[model samples]
Target chain A: MAEPVLSIRDLRKSFGALKATDGVSLDLRPGEIHALIGPNGAGKTTLIHQIAGGITPDSGEVVFLGEDIGALGVAARARRGLGRSFQISSLAPEFSALRNVMLAVQSRQGSSFRFFRPVMKDRSLTEPAMAMLERTGLAARANVPAAELSHGERRQLEIAIALALGPRAFLLDEPMAGMGPEGSRALTAFLDGLRHEAPILLVEHDMDAVFALADRISVLVYGRVIATGTVDEVRGDAEVRRAYLGERP
Target chain B: MSRERAINLLLAGLLLSVPLAALALGELFYITLATRMAILALAAVGLNFALGLGGLVSFGHAAFFGIGGYVAGIFSSHAFNQTPLFSWPFEFFGSDQMPAIWLAAMLISALIALPIGAISLRTAGVYFIMITLAFAQMIYYFAISWPAYGGEDGLSIVVRNGFPGVNTAVPLIFFLVCYVLLLAALALFALVRDSRFGAALQAGRQNETRLAAVGIAPFRIRLAAFTISAAITGLAGALLADLNRFVSPSMLSWQMSGELIVLIILGGTGRLFGPVAGAMLFVLFEFVLGGLTERWQFFLGLILLGVVLFARGGLIGVLAGKARHG
Candidate 1:
C-alpha cells in the first residue's frame, strides 16, 4: 500500500552480444523484503549492480526516494541511503571489524576530512560502531581483522556495516550464500526483523529462507521478471514453476 | 604500553642521542652523516604516507624532491645575485630565508603532485607505478636540457640558507634543526594516521569497492594523500639542498626515487620509524662498507635481497614482531 522506496524501470545491460540484464523492472516498498530468486547466471547480480550504480543500464530509470538517481555515482547513491552487501564478503581485509563499521558510521556522521583529531578516541564513532557489532552478535570478534573473521562472521559484519548506514533501502546480494544451517537460521531471524527498518531488495537462492522471509517474491529468469506477487501467488504461478521451480509430475 | 610503541620511543631516542654524542665528541663529520640520515629518513617518511598507508606504489617521488631542491636553489641564487627573479609578477625578489624557502618548496611540490596524481591515479597496479616513473623521467630530462638553471652542471648556493636566531652554518646547529623537523614530521604522521581521513584513506587502499559502497570516494582520498606526501618530501628536499649547498638534476633521477622506496623497505614498510631505521642502516652500510671496499652497493644489494625474501616486514617488523591490529 505504501509508495516504493526504490524503483527500477525497464533496465537493460548488454555484455557483447548477450544481454546480462534485459528489460528488468522491480520495486521495493516501505517495509517489505522483495526477494528476487533465479537460476544461476540469470543476471540477478547484474540487475543488482545496475541499481547500486556499479553498472549503467543502457536505457532505464532508477528512482530512489522520489528522485531519479540514474546519473549519480556509487558513493553518491550510497550516501542517499542505498545500503548494500556484496555477494562475496566485501570488506577492508586488514581492518578490524570495529574499524570497518566505524568507517560506515563516520560516513553517516559527516566529512572524513577531519584531520588532526584522532578517530580512536572519538566516542561518537566508536559507540555507534560498537552498537552495530553488538546487534550482529559480533561484539566478541570486534577486534579481529576482517581477513581473520570466519566466512559466516564476515557475512554478519557485512550486514552490520549496511545497518550502520541507516539505510532507507537495502540491496543485499546473496546475504545467506556461505552461511551454515545454524548461521542461516540466526540471520534469517535477524533479517526478518530488519525489514521494518528498511525495505530490502534481496537476491538470494535459499528457497526455504526466501519462502520464510519474503513478503513478496519476484521470479527472474534470463534477466526478466516472470512473476511478482505475494509468496503464495508466485508459488502458484505456472510460468514461475516452469521457468524456475519446475513442474510437478 | 605496547612493545611497538616502546620500540618507537627508543628509535626516536636513538636518533636524538647519537647526534648529541657526535656533537659532544666534536665529530663534525659524523654529525653531517647523521644529518644526511635524518634528511633521507624524512623523505622516506613522506613516501610512506602514499606507499605504506595508501597502498600506492609511486616511483616518481624524486620529482617532488627535485622540485623542492630547485626551489631552494633558485630562491637563494636570486637572493645572492641581488636581483629580482621576475619583474613581471610585481618585481618578485627571491629569498634566502630558510622558512620561506621551505614553504615555497612544499607548495611547488604539492602543486606538481596534484596533476601527476590526478593522471596517475586513473590507473592501478604496475600501470600506476610506470606512469609515475615516466613523469619523473620527463622532469629529469627537462632539468638536464634546460640551460637557465645551470643545466646538467647544477646550481650552488653561496652559503647555507638562514634560519631565525640560529647559526645554520654550524654543523651541529644545522643537524639540530633537521632533527627537530624530522621529529615534527613523525608526530604529524602519527596524528594523521589516527584521524578519520586516515581511516578512509586506508579503507580505500585495502578495498576500494568497499570504500565506495560505504559512501566514500577513493579517488579524492588518494589524491589528497598523494599531494600531502609530496609536500612533506618537498620540505625534506629543501633541507637537503641547504645541507649540501647544491641542487642538481640528479635529484629528479629515477635512481633517487628508487632509493627513497629502498629506504622505506629496508627499515620496515609501514612502521612509524621504518624510514629512520632504514636510513640509519643504509648510511652505516655506505660508510662502513665504502671504507672497506668500493663495491659496497653489491653487498647492499645482497642485504636488500635478504630483506625482501625473508624479512618481509622490513627491519622494524623483524625487531618488533608483527603488528597486532594489522
Candidate 2:
C-alpha cells in the first residue's frame, strides 16, 4: 500500500470530566475515501476538528505530508495543503460564488497584500475560479451571491473553494448533509472521482453514500474508534454491529 | 454610469466649488468653514476604511487624530522657539514645514495604531469596541495632564505651518491644499476597496472562519487595515491643528472619536464620499441652525434619529439606492 497522506496518532481531547475524543487513531492513504461514521455526539466532529487544526487535542499528533502539523494554525495548515469544509456550510454570504472561489485562488497564488489592481480584472484568479465552478457544475450560478444560492449549490461552492486551494488531502465533514437524493447522487459521483486527486477523510452520517464510496471504514463510538477495516470486514464485526450498525446490518 | 458614482462626483464637485465661490464673494470665513469640513471629512474617511470595510468599530480613533495634532504642534512650536525637540536622536530640531509635519504625523499615528490594533484585535464585538475606547481615553487624559505642551490650555503655533511655493497663511490657498489632499485620500480609499487585499479583508469581515479556511489570517489583514486607517486620520489631524492654530486634549477626546463614527453613519457607511457629505451637512447645520437658536444640536439629534429610524443606510444610500456590496 502507499504511504498515508494523513495520519492521526492517538489524538485525545477532554472537556473537564468528559473526554470528547479519547485516543483516536486513523490513517488516510492517497486515492482512498476513508469514511468515519458514528452516531450523534460520538465525537466524530471533534476528531475532525483536531485533524483540521480547529480544536487543540490534549495529547496527540496530526501528521500531514510527512510532517507533524499539530502546532500549526487553521490558516497555516491550510496553506500547507490541508483543505477542509465545515459540517455546516461556511461561506462569505455577500460574495458571489465566483468571487468566493477566486479568494481561495488568490490565497493559492500568495500575497493578498496587493492594493492597486482590481481582483475582478485579474484573469489568473478568475479563470481558475471559473474552472473550479464549472467542474462542480455551478458555472451558471457563478454570479449569484452565496447567500442567494440554494443549499446544495452553496455546498458545491464550498467544494469549489476547497478545490481552488490545491489541497494534498481533504478533511470533508458531512459534505452531503443537506443535499437532495439527486444532489447526493451527483455529489457522491463527484467525490468518487475527487478521491484520485486528494485522499478524503470523510465524516458522514449518510450510510448509502459511505457504503458506496468508502474503501476503508472506521466506526467511532463514544470518542473511540471501535473498528477499522475494509467495508465488509467492519460490517461483519460483532462489536461495530452491536455498538453502531445494530439491527440494520 | 452608476448612481453612486454620479453622487460621489456631485459631492466632490460641490466641495470644491463652494470654497472657491466663498473666496470670490469675499466670504473668507466661509472658506475656513469649508476647510473644517474637508479636514473632518478626511478624518472620517480614514475611520471608514476600518469601520465600514473591515467591520471594525473602532471607538478610539481620536487617539490617532490627536497624535497627528500633537506632532504638528510640537514640531512647529519648537521651530518657532528655535529649540531642538530632542538631543540624543542626532540632535533632531523641529520643523515648521507642512510636508514634513504631515509625513511625521502619518508615520507616528501608524506606529501607535500598529500596537493598539495588534493587541485590541485579539478580541471581537463589544470587547473590541470597549478596548479601543479605553485606549483613546488614556491618550486623552495623558494630553490633559502633560504640561510641556501647555496642559489643558493646549499649544498654539505663532504662525500657520509653511508649505513651499504657496502662502498657506492665506485662507483660500490653505483650503485648496486641504481639498487636494482630501481628493488624494478618496482615491486611495477607492483603490483599496477594489484591490485583492480588500477582497480578503471584506471576506474576513463577513466570515472569519471561511477566510482562515481559505488560508488567510484575518488578524493580520485587519491589523494592516487599522494601521493604514490611522495614518490617514493622522494626516487630517495635522491639518486640523494647523487650521485652528491649536492642539488640545479636545482632539484626542472620546467625543471627537464618536463624531467620526457619527459622520460615517450619517453620510453612508462604506460609501466613498460618505465622509465628505456628512461633514458638509454637519458644519452646515452648525452654521445655519446655530444662528437661529443656541440649542442647534437638538435639531442635529432629530436628523440623526431620522437617519437611524428611516434611512438606516444614511444620505448616500437614499440617493444612490442600495449599496453594491452591502
Candidate 3:
C-alpha cells in the first residue's frame, strides 16, 4: 500500500481545563474522503486544527508524509502541500474572487517579486487562477469581490483557494455548516469531485451528506474517536448509535 | 471606467503633472514643496507596510524617520566643520555621503524596530498602538535630553550631504533626487506587496491563526515587515534632513508619528499611491492653510477628525474608492 499522505498517532491537545482533542488517532490515504463527524463541541475542529498545525498537540504526534508537522507553522505546512479551508470565511473580502485565488496561486509559485509589470497583467498567474476557479465552478463569479459572493459561493471560493495551493491533501472544516439544501448539494458535489483529485479530511455534521460521500466515517465524542468504520458499520454500531447516532432521541 | 479606477487615474495624472507644471510656470517653491510631499509620502509608504498591509498601526515610525535625519545631519556637520567625529584610536569618520548615511540610518532603524516589534506584537488592537507610541516617546525623550549634536535645539548641516555626479545645492536637482528615491521606494512597495512574502504579510494581518495553520509564523512575518518599515521610513528621514539641512527632536515626537498615520489614512490605507496622494494633499493643506490662517493645525485637526469619522477610506478612499490589494 502507498504511504498514507497524513498520519496522526495518539494526538492530544487542551485549552486550559478543556481537553479539546484527546488521543485522536487517524490516517488519511491519498484520493479518499474521510469524514470526521461529531456533534457541536465534539472536538472535531480541534482535531483538524492540530493536524493542520494551527494548534500544537500537547502530546503524541501528527506526522504528514513522514515529517512531524504538528510543530511546523501554517505557511510551512501549506508549502508542504497541506491546504485547508476555514470554518469561517477568512478571505480578503475587499479583493476580487479572482485576486483571492490569484494570491493563493501567487503564494504557490516561487516568486511574486516581479514589480515593474502589474500582477493583474501577469497572464501566467491569472490564467491558472481562473482555471482553478473554473474547476471549482466559480468561473462565473471570478470578477466579483469575495465579499460580494454568496455564502455558498464564498465557501466554493474557499475551496478554490485551497485547490490553488496544489495540495496533496485538504482539511475542510464544516464546508456545509451554514448552507441551504441547494448550497449543501452544490458543496457535496464539489467535495465528491474533489476526492478523485486528493485526500480530504472533512469535518462535517450533516450525516446524510457525510454517509453519502465519505469513504470512511469516524464518530468522535468528547474529543475521542469512539468509532471508525464503513458507513454501515458506524450506522449499526450500538456504542456509536448510543453515543451520537441514537442520542437524537 | 469604474469610479475607483477613474479617480485613481485622475489623481495619478495630476500628481505626475504637478512638478512638470511647477517647472513650466517657474514656481520654484512648488518644486521644494513637491519634494517635501514626495519625501513625506515615502515615509508614509513605509508606515503603510506595517499599517495597511500588516495591520500594525505603528505610532513610532517618526523615531526611525528622525534617526535617519540625524545620521545625515551628524555626518554632514562633521564634514562641514572638518572635525574628527568622536575619533577612535584607529578609525576616521567624516564621510557625508547620502548613501552611507542612509545605510546607517536603515540599520539603526531596523535594529530598533526588531525589539519594539517583539514587544508590541505580543498585544493586539489598542494595546499595540499604545505600546508603539510609548516606545516612540522613549526615543523622543532620548533625543531631547542627549546633548551630543545640539541637544533639544538640534543639529544643522551647513551643506547638504553629497551624492555622486549630482549638484546637491540646486533645489531642482535636490527635488529630482528625492523624486527618484520616492519612485524607487514606490517600486519597492509594489514589489513587496505582490511577493509571496507580501501575501504572508497580509495574511498575518487578516487571519494570523489561518496563516499559522498554513505553516508561517505570524511573529516572524510581522517582525520582518516592521524592520523593513522602519528602514524605509529611515530613508525618508535622511532625505527630510537634507531638505531642511537640519535635524530636531521635533521630528521624533509623537505628533510627527501621528502625522504619519494621518498621511496614510488621508491617502487611503493599503492603496499603492495612497501615501503619495496623502503626502501631497497634506503638504498642500499645510501650505495653503498656513497661508490662510495661523491656526491652520486646529482646522487641520478638525478636518482630520472628520475624515476619520466620516470618510472611512480617507482621500484615496474618497477619490478612488476601494482598491484591489493582491
Candidate 3 residue lDDT tens string, B225-247:
89899999998999999999899
- The DockQ assigned to candidate 3 is 0.33
Runs of candidate 3 exceeding 4 Å displacement: A111-117, A247-249, B1-34, B86-90, B118-123, B194-200, B209-221, B291-294
**lDDT of candidate 1 over B1-326, digit per residue (tens):** 88778888888888778778987888778888999999999998999899977889999999999999999999999999888999994887789999999999999999999999999999999999999999999999999999889899999988999999999999888988998899988898888888999899888888999999999988888999999999999999999999999999999999999999999999998678889999988988999999999999999899999999999889899989975542
Sort the candidates on lDDT, descending order: 2, 1, 3
Candidates, DockQ: 0.75, 0.70, 0.33
What is the Cα-based TM-score of model 1?
Answer: 0.98
Error in Å for residue B277 of model 2: 1.9
Q: Compared with the true structure, what per-residue lDDT tens digits does model 2 show for residues B218-273?
A: 99999999999999999999999999999999999998998899899899888888
**For residues A1-249, what per-residue lDDT tens digits would candidate 3 score against the true structure?**
779889899988888899888888988988889999978898998887777766788998888888988677777888788889989887877667887787777768754444345567678779999998998889998989788899988888889889988888999998887889988987888789888888999998887789989988998899999999889988888888788876653
Residue range A223-247, candidate 2, lDDT tens digits: 9999999999998999998899875
**Global lDDT of each model?**
0.92, 0.93, 0.84
Residue pairs with colliding backbones in model 2 are none
In model 2, which regions exceed 4 Å deviation?
Answer: none
